[model samples]
Target: MRIAAITRDRPPHTKHTAEVVNANTVVSISFFAAFCPVSSRRFPAIGFERHSDEAKNKGNDFVAWNSLISSFASIGNASGAKNAFDAMPGWTIVSWNALLDAYARKGQQLRRMESLLDAMPEWNVVSWTIMLKAFTKEGQIDSAVAVFDSMQERSLISWTIFLQAYAARSGHLAQARNVFERMPQHDAVSCNVMLVAFAQAADPASAKRVFDSMRQWTDVSWISLLAAFARNGNLEGAKNTFDTSPFRNLLLSTAMLQAFAQSGHIDQAQAFFESMPEWDLVAWNTLLTAFAQAGDLYSALPVFRKMPVKDIVSWTSLLRACSRDPAAASIVFHSMPQRDIVAWTSILEIYSQAGELGAARSTFDRMPELDTICWTAMIFACSRSSAGEQALELYALMQMEGWNPNGVTCLNVLAACAHLGLVDRCQGFLGSMILDHGLSPGIEHISCAIDLLGRMGRLEQAEELLRAMPFSPDAAAIRALLSSSRTHRDVDRARRRARSSCSSLATIPLLSNAML
Candidate 1:
């Protein structure tokens, strides 16, 4: 059937046109169906399916069925490919390979791939590699190694696959090197892949060893090694590698700047910035992040204003830095080109910190959507600003709207209850933590509860609750009780309880060391 199609193009025979060709060879048939033009009257899809069915009727010849399955797989219809595999009367090596390839694309079909492999009458190198690659991609490295062990002929491809798999997992760096050493033929790619793996694992020593061992090093190898040094917080090593290089590349330089910024060497980072022959957006952002980390929001402002372009991270970093300084917080907040939840939350925190709950509430009310962090930020802001009533209201609304409170949220809400003298409401909030959220109360939550009880003159119950807790009382809890007692003039009782709390705390080094 393929011959007829080839012959027709060479010599125009009256009987040898595409019209006369039988759709018996499904491989050619499915391929033609995918690319061939359709008449206006006939639906292209229906014609394609009809040709596909004719191709399938060829009794699962490895050549024909492989092509048919590939046609369906190319269109991202895995179920259709599965159906085509099922209809095959019998299978050959090519046919099984095609089916396995289809199943590997859909990660959810690992069981199906395994079942097909188990039922196969014989195995080949291609079959084993397919299974190994599937397991490696799914992060099942142990299973991939097991398949490699079972292979009778170990090829370089097989060795490289396992090496790449270990490198990708990061935790298996030693095993990745073992495979690289054992490979009989070391190609450029094999060395490069190992270098990348070591780089990602933050082992510059191993990466440098691979770099030195390579007979030929490409631009890719240099970038990979430089990136490793950057990620491992080795800016000096990265700079040394960059300086000795015959070729200068922007990516390598950018990696060095990023490393310096991340490690908190702002002066060194600025020096690198000035050393750059030219600056790009990435370099600018690196400098911006350095200033943010240093808590020098004033220095970050000029960089933010001068950037040729800005992304979400740029805006968020500046906003967060501004949040720490109340005077500039609102200015930066209003000047943002685009605001994400992080930007909005930073502003909310600023207002909360400055004791302007009205502005903080206004910001919260204006937010387009409230994520968990946003809710937590707003709750904390109000709690600290002495607007506990507003904080409680927001907490109730959060629950009614189906937003689950996390540990931070629970701590903030408990603090609000303590600050507002909401004694009865505190018990209900505690019940909700156990019943609805199923979160165990941590020291922060317990401390807030103790403070609430002590402030309301329920000293006996608070002491009992403190004793009943699995963990001993924390410094904050003891201090809250003492403060409440001193205010109420219960000096005798306060002194004894204080002594007992201090004695209990001595068993833990951190608690005992902390000055109250």
Candidate 2:
């Protein structure tokens, strides 16, 4: 019963059981004794006891001794395994190998593992493999290579692990290719790793070269090349790779579908999606997201209704898809089996974005909880709908409710004051952004305050404020100045020309080959 209890591997519960386990007593010895009625050779991997020294002197329990050593080693207790080894009256090659394995697996002690390996009386392919993996785990690349060169024999797995170390390192592509060219044995995994490495580096031409040289291609080969082309924005090359591949699985199809969607080839994205022999929920969601991004709810709405399973992600995609249409968003909201905070938040944003302030307020009132983002979104919604005063009121209520405003929330409050041309409130919010919230006002926040000054016909104060900014004044601040100049119609043409030139330089993109 004690042997069964130990072998079951449940957590220690009672005091008696904990004492039995801690003592490492006859419970471990009994594990080997719990054999089948027919044969001791068929003993289960439970605990065991060492018999009298007389039995050890007689050499009758060699098999049981070796099994106990291996079992403890397998459990990662190096000290216990070593103690079991010291208890052995004789040793075999298997005992040495087991002890080596235990030492190798002891975490992050590479120097100790190397010393242990040096102490082994004899070594085999298994010993070399263990050493290779230990070195690989520590990222000791030079030591791994030295071990690889000294090996009298190498298996396919060993060779592949050696090559992968090079492929996994940055700026070591030449080394990886050199090793691949010299491989005496070629297998699919090793070949695919090189291909995938180049693909991950966004080198589609090099990847294709490797692909063409393969004696045969796996589905992984096809997927790697497809992903490489997609990442490089070679849509035509991606399609060609897809069409010529011998097989098409869901993963490859999804890769192509996403590539087309990101490149604004919505028509091709839809086509690839429909061509898949099987459609998982991810595929459906991807299609919905593509259509939604194109703002073509005419296609997305029908698909959402036909899905056999609708998780929160599916509904959220549809809600975000139909953001331009509050009525459609509301219909999806009412149909949810249950809604989480994200769902409630999305509906609130949809109503807010469409300028339905009363509808937004009703939804906000129904919310079971509120966070800073919810408060900010409502504030932004009010300003967008020309209710600047109401937006300010909500900001006050948010503060009273013990919700400290974040950078975005503070910025939205400033924008509301700007819309209403409330100069005092604008200055107060800008100061509060720095001192109260510990957030330095970014250029956009200052731009908003300057707009408030411009709208109030304080052109000179706005100009003075722009000159006082710690960083270079951006185009928005200059445009604020221009707007005030238009209000006055007294600024010189040369001043307007100078401001326009600054805006032009800031707007034009500086590309990599600008000197050319």
Candidate 3:
């Protein structure tokens, strides 16, 4: 149960990235069974691998093979793990479990995991639980149920894993709740999973109800409810939830840090960050992002300079801090020891916002590489400078370079077309956005498209487009349609436009006159 040391000296186990205590716990029990009293000094692993060779663990004639097997399994190299396991002169139940963990790391390798389980000389409670977890991971509820029925025995760990699987499957809420109710043993993890499921489904109140009902809570329970409240924009509720936690772990602290930072409580965020006993790169980068997002350059710059480590995130945060000040941003950018695609885009956005097309263009051209966001920034950069033609050129070049345009990029392209009064080109871009890029036309893109249609005296088509939009016509879309209706002075269309604009702006008392 004391797995903290097992995963120590290695990166924390992120469920998405690696297995947790389970792999190492099993390894500790079984793998070391082969060789005891082995020295822990490691030798280099053979072949191309990022991992150092595990501890040579030589015990004279009997070498301990478990550490090597565990290391291979942790990295999800089933082949390497198996090779090590097979080369072993003997096997233990823990060794079999470690192999299963290795195979289960990748959910797609489920069939192989099943086969490996079948080949096990004998099975233990851990072995069966491992198999249950494998099915649970793949979200195969019915198959997991089949295994459960056939299970001669089960543990709380297996029971909890099964309960958690229901939450992972979106439509199985009732089933998940039912499983939670049926549990003879009540544990915080199983309870927290249900709470997190409710939170993700945008039912923070339900999460709260669950939290209140818990006889005893874990750190995860408090953190889940705190995050849920914050995510739902109940900042006051989140703070209250944070206050009630019996203890604070890193995950809880980071969650509170983010909640405070995002809600614009910079001082609270700083206080929380300073209060933490330890910090990770994410924690540092998060604080930097908080200041950058608030445009607190004075605060952000010092933090940037003071950070003991700086990665792409740190650099990008610094650039974002000065995004509104092109010259300052460029100064920070040029002084960077390194520049990646994000760093390029951050400075590009600054120039684009300032409408310094030349500077933005230079930044774009010099980028070592460009992804969709970078290319989109270039198009938006040109859109601001009355250089619709140039923006179109960038859009074309973006496609030529094989970067698929996103919805935001399509919005920029449509804006360029509107500025140039290229109704035909706007139509072409809209077609490409929907048919080629598969982007849904949002309000911004719709507004630009409508304006382009109107400029060509195609008032009827513009009105039709607005009416056909999937979303309700926003103020911009409404305005574009109204502008076109008046330009062509089609009486019927103008009257209809006036009525709709009035309805859309009904709450804004003075805007009715402007719309009419």
Candidate 4:
């Protein structure tokens, strides 16, 4: 009998044929044995041993042993679960599966799971599925496919997971669709995955087709389709879908509100928000974002004040709305209950945009942690203020702090070098951007380099760079060269540049004429 079935009213001693047994003693031991593994507080080694002794005395069955293993596994104590499994005189496939799950949940133990799978006397479909899931979770898609192919039998869950693996990748939508079509059956879950995938890709037409084909619709199906329309900027389609939904859930209502906001229909968004029976934090934030997007700070402030509860996003949204007034933005920043990196970066941008270099630097220094965005913003601020030397210094410091320069970071750095007339440094930085960082230099980057070269009187090199540029040089590049030519009194080169500019751009004619 299970220890849990025992009652206090039962006799302390019960007669069993020729022998008398102590029922209360048995109950006490068995109860602790089953309960110790699941206790909130960790038991000492002696406590575990005592429980094991009790179970052994009672000739504990497989169910009790499996329960013990699972309880330990549930708490993420893989070693404890292993000890329980080893202590058992014998184990069933269920016991082995529990141990495998312990390892799987611990993660980064794929090889250990593989070894255990090999050692098992036998495994069922559950075993294979667990291994497949482990592979997928580890991002070993190719290996997961190999395992799936080897499975003699696959469950619906296995097939769905396989589809999701492909769907989650950006360029693998085709493969995901093929899997969906090949499945022996489809559920709302599988259909929703494909619908969301297409929606994220901004292919609303395909998403609609999938939605129509579904045998049944879930709330997620409605929301995904609504989101698809919003993503595509089809506000009218979003409204039609919302009106048609039989259930007007809070989640669906919030999605529709977002659709109106995304399309710049602030009045409609406000109206829709007012109409909702309930509002969640996400809904409130969405309404606030609408006013911020329209630069309607006056409208956003009242909504922010009215919100009963405010989170970091709520505070950040209000900070963004105050972008035009740096003093007001500073007030908001100081008033935030807690500030995350986004909040910190927003305040930094406000100061930098106002050309307040001293205040910007102070804010940058006060940041407890720095990310790539924060670093780039500070560097750009320096470059814009013509503090080229300081910007370069920060760039070097950023690299030392293990933040790699992104494309925007590279652009700002090159501009700094140009402002300081560091021609050789600018050329080297441009090369690093391409070869070291694996970034494709755009036209703006090339223009900065050409301007630097022109400023340094390396006209021959500047002209060579312009000719060899992969992108057609814009007016700015031509003007930089023309200005340099006139400064050096190179009439012949100025005339040649004017003729070339006239052929490419109509607007360039006026600037070229002025330069000549």
TM-score of each: 0.55, 0.52, 0.70, 0.74
In every candidate, how many clashes are there?
Answer: 1, 8, 2, 0
In model 1, how many backbone clashes occur? 1
- Extract clashing residue pairs from model 2: 28-47, 28-48, 29-48, 29-49, 30-48, 31-46, 31-47, 31-48
Ranking by lDDT: 4, 3, 1, 2
User: Which of 2 and 3 is ahead in lDDT?
Assistant: 3
- The residue-by-residue lDDT of candidate 4 on 284-370, one tens digit each, is 999998887776789999999999999999999998888788899899999999999999999998888888889899999999889
Better of 1 and 2 by lDDT: 1
Segments in model 2 whose C-alpha atoms lie over 4 Å from true places = 1-249, 399-407, 434-443, 467-475, 493-516
* Lowest summed lDDT window (length 10), candidate 3: 1-10
Clashing pairs in 4: none
Candidate 3 runs further than 4 Å off: 1-68, 75-83, 90-97, 103-187, 190-203, 209-216, 249-251, 267-284, 306-311, 396-403, 504-516
- For candidate 2, give the lDDT: 0.72
Q: List lDDT for all candidates, in order.
A: 0.73, 0.72, 0.74, 0.80
Q: For residues 312-345, what per-residue lDDT tens digits would candidate 3 score against the true structure?
A: 8898898899977888897889888888877888
Q: Candidate 1 — what's its lDDT? A: 0.73
lDDT of 1 by residue, 128-158 (tens): 6667667787888777777777777665666
Instruction: Give the candidate number with the greatest lDDT.
Output: 4
TM-score of candidate 1 relative to the true fold: 0.55
Cα distance off (Å), candidate 2, residue 3: 38
